[model samples]
Target: MYSKTILAAAAIAGVQAQSSINSTSGYLNYTTVTGYFLQDLASTNVSTFDYTATNFGLINRTYPATAGLKANLTQWQQFEAQVNALNADAPLNTAYKVLFLGRHGEGYHNAAQTFYGTPDWNCYTSLLNGNATASWFDADLTPNGIEQALIAHDFWAHEIATQKIPYPQSYYTSPLTRCLKTANLTFSGLDLPQYYPFVPSVRELLREGISLHTCDHRRSRTYIHDLFPTWNIESSLTENDELWNGVTAETSDAQDARSKIVLDSIFSEDDHTWISITSHSGEIASILRVLGHQSFSLSTGAVIPVLVKVTFLPSGPPPSNPPYTTSTHCAAPPVTSIASLAQGCVCSGTAVGGITTPIFNISSDYPTSAGYQATDLGPVVTSAPAISSYSY
Candidate 1:
């Protein structure tokens, strides 16, 4: 991945030498992640993201915010920093609560399509040969992804000192390598006097939309523990991935149910007023839906701050597949099947977007796969907007 971004000088003294070349970053630095889908010439038909609009800070809009509580690039970065600072200083009685939503940076899978082309390159042909899987399995951050995270770190560090926003007292991340890596990179270098060693919790529920794709099949738990020794993972997760099966994928309702579980666990805990959840684009959309907000799209490495009002009713049973509809994004076509796979199994209509769910049809509209759209729930849970900021 670094090879794609930073220009490397020839080896010096049997060691790698750093090149001084600029203009080497992979994927021209488009401010938003969704922008890639729009900007790719190959995907010209895909709708361009409304970068100029106020999109709840999910897309890469610039800060201070436009009207409508939209995020500029710095929304989460600034919020998280302020959260820690405020949490460390607030009086014992004051509990300032906020939820910070963030999406992971670009991974090998995102870059793969551009390099290999789609359909066969995206399906069994590329996956079975290990050509794509080798580079994208449980994809980690591309060089550009890391750079985005670095920008997040600097932005947060600068904002907490200067801006007035709630920073996160607790941090959570998806189990995927791309998301975990992004979380670590975004929060590692901050100079928070309150929480120096702010180790984030890894929740399996935070994983991306489940699918048969190799990129969706996470590494084993033991392997994950080894990879992220510092992260505090949920004890409940016992397998590499519990939901994804090559033959079938998780439905929007199922994913939303999972999102509810994530929230239930969080609200169950008494502490951590302002929390941060770092996950994939699909999972993030699920979260917004479960929280009763308009579905919003997010660019990788971007953040949104929502003033959420959650009502916890532990004794009551959870809603049964909340009444909802997903705007379909999958478009299917026949492709050569994997020796162990079926012809119509992958890339089927409305299922092509197995990992990310559906395309965010409108700039501010939620992506197709959101959870809990039912209106008859016992408690009233509402999600309103708040301000956002960042540094770099």
Candidate 2:
């Protein structure tokens, strides 16, 4: 992926030599081309905004590029035509693409987070594979999650039938189960163009932000292939997850750097202007930041479309991406949680031995183990005068 953005340099004395490229040789610049989507409008309150009601945030207006077209064309049709025009007239090293970013529906992890509350979820529950009730390691979508995806399916059908919205020319999804399931449900039966099929390429980089949470970990590539055999997996992907260390979480800056690299890979390799990416909240947020879009958080099952303008730069210094930082966790379920503090889980009892990562025993329901032995879950201490925080 770095091939597109960074120029290769010679290795000096068995160590990689850094290229001394000036302003003429490295990197790409991404700018969000506003005015095409209502999400970019200053007055559109994201919290109260519903895309299903507002025609996917498309501004129902004319475009000068499609001025000579038929007057009866729908807003979507006009928008598509204008996008085509923009691409057709684009100069060297410049291109426009519309990215449909869809977040995976409610996963068991999300429900667990809600059930346990954020503080406990962040501190204790997230570290374990599951409680007595539900499992969240590489969590699957809940029942409502399926319904949410179906709603997206129905909306897309409506848009295709009435609005003639441009269907995605290419499809991509995160390797995680929830995202894979969401992408499948949302696009499988759509009345799509002959050239554009529902076959999405599973990208390793598209998964949720790297973290110690078991849900953030992904199953093996073989397991993913067994489930979605028809979908193409990026050849570079390893069979097992090699990135997750179960000790640290990616900083926001680190996530943004990853997001930039992935976007760079897509833009350099793919020619499609309309692309669909089914991923997680954190990843989409990072991508939006890289694209220079405003911070508009998406609810699960919601989608955002952004018009992006990419410029290939000749040369620039590479960015310094910070390393992942260790996350604080509780050895046992905290007696009480503090929402205001980072070390919020107030644990009196010491966690003896907590399972850091999932046990890789294959099952139909879980690609990994059904649940791991959380030795850390000792008898809950009722009260404590002093508490100590632990890092997983």
Q: Which candidate comes out best when scored by lDDT?
A: 2
| Alpha-carbon runs more than 4 Å astray in model 2 | 1-25, 335-345, 349-392
- List, residue by residue over 41-147, the lDDT tens digit for candidate 2: 77789888887998989988889867877678899888877776666566555667789999999999999999988867877888778888888989999999999
Q: For each candidate, what is the lDDT?
A: 0.52, 0.75
RMSD of 1: 18.6
lDDT of 1 by residue, 139-183 (tens): 778898888777777666655654433456678888888888888
* TM match of model 2 to true structure: 0.83
Model 1, runs deviating above 4 Å:
1-96, 116-134, 314-392
Model 1 lDDT-worst window of ten? 383-392
